[model samples]
Target: MSQLQDNFGRRFHYLRMSVTDVCNFKCSYCLPDGYHPTGKQHFLSLSEIENLVSAFSQVGTQKIRITGGEPTLRKDFTDIVRIVSDNPSIHTVATTTNGYRLAQHAKEWFDAGLRRINVSVDSLDPKMFYQITGENKFDEVMRGIDAALTAGFERVKVNAVLLKGMNDKDLPRFLNWIKNTPIDLRFIELMETGLGRDYFQAHHLAGADIKAQLQSQGWSLDIADIDDGPAQNFSHPDYRGRIGLIMPYAKNFCATCNRLRVSAKGKLHLCLFTESGLELRDLLQHPDQQAELIERLHAQLAQKKETHYLHQGITGVTQHLASIGG
Candidate 1:
């Protein structure tokens, strides 16, 4: 019904929903140090988001991921998850979070129907964490990770946004834990966005750098085959556990890009880094317009550009990571 596709055959059927664009910990890659929107923003009601997903599912889109400024920040997050997961057409129900609140919500989320969790745990060091996230809640975040494992969620992933002069050099420490623990640590290439109109061009971290760092540490690795998505495959030398790299910026995974995003405000974004979005708040508010919303989505998706120019450099990404729903 919708037609957002590149010259490549990959069709955009995945939906990355940003329930709320407000995050408690403002990470370097997510938001600028002191960036703020001029006007007050409103979040999409639970019903509004549900209707949009229901419409998308009716069309061939099967994957749905709940993203956020921090998804847990939403008071009705569990209710929202239940609505989408309850839909038979939705094969996967996942979320990308900061993990600051996962410990308390993991069990509830698992019971509600979230099968996959991708949490952003940048570094283990308290000092570095404070440096990266202008906050001091590392302990809480870790607690959430432990809780997620205990909650019975089968696929638990750790997404680390590798930033230059910040956490990239600490790969050995991160990967070391992955080798011992039964968790999959995903190393994401630092993306440019919201607070990143400038500033981060020189600090960009690429997937090659991550690979090189692992090689230098003599950490034997193998590319992982974690179903499908952007992240390049990588695995622990011998352990059953694995690691992933999402080089969406430099390498341009746009060829196999099959994802779409709906913001908390109800606008649907076909790509992560751009400003173009189709407002669905009204369509969701009006049931009769669901077809119109679906048709608009197809048209917008067909217009998806090749790659994101976030940081505005050879390897820069054009959009903000936080706004992109990670």
Candidate 2:
């Protein structure tokens, strides 16, 4: 099997595949209210997804992160994990979910070889959580987090998108909660993308500020050598779990990028902040074109931009996080 390397000398080994664009939640930063779902025919079938994963695995993708607007919302969610985990070359399989329905399938997902999970929980306060997610299912999501922990997955992470006047005030509460639990907590800086650019600009909070606040609170932090995607991880002396900061705007990690994204509609996105991609749905429909498709994919990856233009004061990709499989 040949390895896929970009023009910048980065070897791709991870793939984030979105199974569906449909989501139940209407997070203010992700999807707006009354967002329309993609048509069912646009989604790839189970066999097609498996085949695509097989193609990527053959080309040295060892880690597969199943994603979606909400991955568990897909009917074949468990099956998707089972198939991807079955790949001999794929050593790790994980998923990022909103955690609304994770409790019902956590055990099943664990049995299907899923070892890592990232759940998005913005606020611990029910009212604030509802305000941020635009949903009243905070209790359900909390149950889902507990279920993931109870299921005994190797790594269960909590992703909190920090906003200036919103959840940023709850950083202490988040730290206090994680200090007692085994799950790691990651604070992601608000990114300017799609129609949320204005909102992000208005509410964006720098991860550096958050880190400083934590330090001022007497939490000793030591930079840890841990690379999971682009997050800069740090360990606190008082906590059993580590804290992470994903500052895409303040400290971009594009130089060490090693993954690719496949949108739910089968488009191959080389960079999350770029609109350019190669359509692969037609290629997947023909089994005989597998070799050719792989070759084309490699070519497309080779042309990936050296870095995103967000830091240049340019608006990022116009696609919403939901459409991009965040």
Candidate 3:
């Protein structure tokens, strides 16, 4: 009875829990300029987050990922991973970070039974780095990536957001970097989020053009199947690891999307693109209403949009990417 299967006949198994709306780095594509952080009232306590994740586990939720403004900014990050890891039905507990804090937090989270780590690093150029993230700490991110490697995160994946005129020219370089190093690389097409499209309007490089660029570079990569999550993975012919691509405009995967996002404020979002969400903060107040909350959640889940509408993140909601839980 807990199974809320989607239109694709796939059970929505993965829960992307956004721990906090506080991110250290404000990337141009993600948050843009003048983006203010969220207040404390919007955040869910460690206990509340763990309790909800635990309930989802009872209903056959096996995968949970912690995201945030930057998940590492949360003090209880490691505990969140630990709590989810201990759940019997939860097969994987992962987090996607900006990697700035990974240098210190990597081993701790890894020891807490975290299964995977995804780092968002769009470009390799340091000067371009400043223009993109408004932060001169690109070196810190690289160091963090190395730390994750040293911490036993054998397959740390790098998420690169591709823009038509901006970093799209570096597709060859990204592939070469993967071929040379042990790190995993994935290309993400830029979404016209309310904040992103408003400030940044560079042409969005299509997926086919991206594919052609890599193929023309003579890179032989194979596709990897890691659920219907954003990235469509591709591996080099003789490489040790693979590369991934998550296309929004060219190839939207909303059809097979089994993702559910929980905002930092305790709102359970059934679809990333849709503004509709079920509030869990009120439900948490009356613990007796837990079953009612679950039923409401299931109803919302079934109505998960086939995919996100492309006018971008114009929900009139002020929640930034940090609060959106990525």
TM per prediction? 0.89, 0.94, 0.89
Per-residue accuracy of model 2 over 162-253 as CA lDDT, tens digit each: 98888878976887787878878889988888687689778998888977876776656555332257777777667877788888776546
Residue ranges of candidate 3 with Cα displaced over 4 Å? 38-40, 198-200, 216-228, 285-290, 311-320
Error of 2 at 206 (Å): 0.8
| Clash count for each candidate, listed in order shown | 19, 0, 4
| Per-residue C-alpha lDDT of model 3 across residues 28-126, encoded as one tens digit per residue | 767665347444455787768767876677666778888887887777778888888988888878889888888877888889998689898878888
lDDT value, residue 249 of candidate 1 = 55
lDDT winner? 2
Write down the TM-score for model 3.
Answer: 0.89
**Cα RMSD to native, each candidate?**
2.9, 1.9, 2.7
lDDT of every predicted structure (CA atoms) = 0.75, 0.84, 0.72
Full candidate order by lDDT, most accurate first: 2, 1, 3
Looking at candidate 2, the ten consecutive residues that score lowest on lDDT are 219-228
Report the C-alpha lDDT of model 1 over 81-122, residue by residue, as the tens digit.
998899998888999888877887899999999999988788
TM-score: the better of candidates 2 and 3: 2
> Which ranking of candidates, highest TM-score first?
2, 3, 1
Tell me, by TM-score, which candidate is best: 2
